[model samples]
Target: SQTIHQWPATLVQPVGSPLSLECTVEGTSNPNLYWYRQAAGRGLQLLFYSVGIGQISSEVPQNLSASRPQDRQFILSSKKLLLSDSGFYLCAWGGDTEAFFGQGTRLTVV
Candidate 1:
């Protein structure tokens, strides 16, 4: 079966602290992967995406970076946290027509 694993369902971090979130897909190869952030009561914002190993595309520019270290793994990282960074982060994998999402990570930066 195909599934996506995303970790640390919720987080609270002090401002200026570092952050890392991870997601991995199983039972699929070369799926397009994405990282999205949803602010309170707002639509989702695409942060990063990857189509293959070592190929990443950034949809928005801010305090975050993403990496595809392996075929099935994606990581989102930040050097410093900001209060505005707090949100619901989601990881998803897709083919051309459909996408599946992981249970999101809710982040709060204080």
Candidate 2:
């Protein structure tokens, strides 16, 4: 079965703290992976994406970075957190036609 798993489903961190969020996809290889942020009443914003290992594309400039350490593992990290960074972070993986999303992590930076 193919599935995507994201962890620490919810988080509360003080400003200037560090953050690391992870996601892994199973049952697939060389999949297109994505990291997105969703804020209340707003559409999803693509933060980073990877088409293959070591091939990351950033959609916007922000306080976050992403890395694919393995074929199926993706990580989002931040060295210093900010209150404005609080949001619902999502990880997804897919082929050209369909995509599957993880449960997501709700981050609150104070």
Candidate 3:
């Protein structure tokens, strides 16, 4: 069975601090991985995606970055946090048409 794990579930961080969010998929190989952000009551926005290890594509110009360290692991990071960066972050993995999402992480910047 394939499963995705994304962490810290929820976070409260001070502004200007560094941030790291991790996601890892099990029982899958070379799956397409993506990082997304959903603002309160807004549609999902794709932040980054990777088709394979060391391959990443950014969908938006934001303070976040994504990386695929292993075939089934993805990480989202930021050098410095911003108030606008607070949102619900999701990690997903899928095949051509179907995707599986993690529980999601809610981050609040203060």
The CA lDDT at 1 in model 2 is 84
Off by over 4 Å in 2: none
Ranking by TM-score: 3, 1, 2
What are the per-residue Cα lDDT tens digits for candidate 1 across 1-110?
Answer: 99999998999999999999999999999999999999995899999999999999999789999999999999999999999999999999999998899999999999
Residue lDDT tens for model 3, 1-110: 99999998999999999999999999988999999999995899999999999999999898998889899999999999999999999999989998899999999999
Residue pair clashes in candidate 1: none
Candidate 2 residues 14-71, lDDT tens each? 9999999999999988899999999883799999999988889999999999999899
lDDT of each: 0.96, 0.94, 0.95
- What C-alpha lDDT does candidate 2 achieve relative to the native structure? 0.94
lDDT of 3 at 15: 97
Model 3: lowest-lDDT 10 consecutive positions: 40-49
Residue 79 error for model 1, in Å? 0.3
Instruction: Compare candidates 2 and 3 on TM-score and give the better one.
Output: 3
For model 1, the local distance difference test gives 0.96
